[model samples]
Target: MKLSISRYNPELDSRPYMQDYEIALVPGDHMLLDVMLRLKQQDSTLSFRKSCREGVCGSDAMSINGRNGLACITPVRTLHGTVVLRPLPSFPIIRDLVVDMTNFFQQYHSIKPWLENPEPPPEKERLQSPAERERLNGAYECILCGCCSSQCPSYWWNPDKFVGPAGLLQAYRFIVDSRDKATDERLENLRGPYRLFRCRTIMNCAEVCPKGLEPSHAIEKTRMRMLHVEASGELDTHTPPAGRPSITN
Candidate 1:
């Protein structure tokens, strides 16, 4: 099998290029990541990220045959011809097939993905009823692999302002958690034009998610919550202070 992988080194090359490698496919070899590992064995300088070899880690996400997905889960045999591999689009390339994820994580952090509750802790851990827990099923499964967000046109245009599908999915995750005490505050922080409204419902996020999670659905739920807040006359009170950073589209 032949793999044409994108190669880039900011220190050495001004732009990215492709390099081809031929690997002898064995009976047990199936996944694209396995093929990459075989290629790396021949050229030790080839760089990429992988962890857990399973798709759970989401670290091996890249453009495979012009689609965004986790290489760890993609079967190499499913690809008909020469395979083309590239880093996740719209991110700073660190090296061959490795994109810098600093901005991706920053957007995640901006949403405060953790549960926020200022109330005193209970004797036991905070627990949710089964029905409440079910609300998080789709939203909580996100592995934070760059696939969905990298494929999003809105995020590509407003990378700095829009939190993107992964962040918004997590935002919905916390927003719907019955135990979280900061639902209102979370909604307040995301009230800006780009923060929550930039999602055009293009469905690219849901289409490329390796986990089959529907980030667009979660985004819609968040939008409904914002509308509910507005209709209830609750939006005026939580206006951010003057000179506060505004995330606009």
Candidate 2:
């Protein structure tokens, strides 16, 4: 099969380029990552990231056929012809199929991903009712692969300011947790023109998530919760002018 993989070396080449390869598909070559491994044998210089190879580590995420996905889970048989692979889009390329994830991680860290409860700790782990726990269903499955956030155009434009989908999904994860006590503070932190409101709900984040999570939905839920707080006067904010749509919209 013909494969076009992006190649780059700061020490040698000035810019990125695609290098084609023709490899014989072997018996164990079931996923895209398998082909990548075979190609690696042919050219040791080819650079990429892979670990766990089970879609859990989320290390092998890249742009396959113009869509961001984890190579470990993408079936080779599902690809058509001349499979094209590249680093995640709109990210600074560190090398072939590898990107600088510093900005992505910075936005993620800004959300305060862990649970916050200043109240007295429980003797055991904090327990939640079954229904309360169920609120975290879709938000808890994010693997921080950078697939959703990298594909988001808002993040592409405002990588530093926007929390992006993955971070927002993580933020909502703690916000809806029954055991968390800092939901208001978490929402307040996201209060700004760019941080959370920049999401256009384009659904690209939902489309490329390897874990089938809906980050756009999570972003919408966050927006709704913010609006609820604003309406209740719980947050120090002003009402929108008459006949003018609120920025939260």
> Which candidate should be chosen as best, given TM-score against the real structure?
2
CA displacement after TM-score superposition, residue 81 of candidate 2 (Å): 0.5
- Per-residue accuracy of model 1 over 159-215 as CA lDDT, tens digit each: 999999999999999999998989889998888778878888888999999999998
lDDT of 2 by residue, 159-187 (tens): 98889999999999999999999999999
Residue 42 accuracy (lDDT) in model 2: 92
- TM values, all candidates: 0.93, 0.95
- What C-alpha lDDT do the candidate models reach, one value each? 0.88, 0.90
TM-score of 1: 0.93
The superposed Cα distance between candidate 2 and the true structure at residue 70, in angstroms, equals 0.4
The lDDT leader among the candidates is: 2
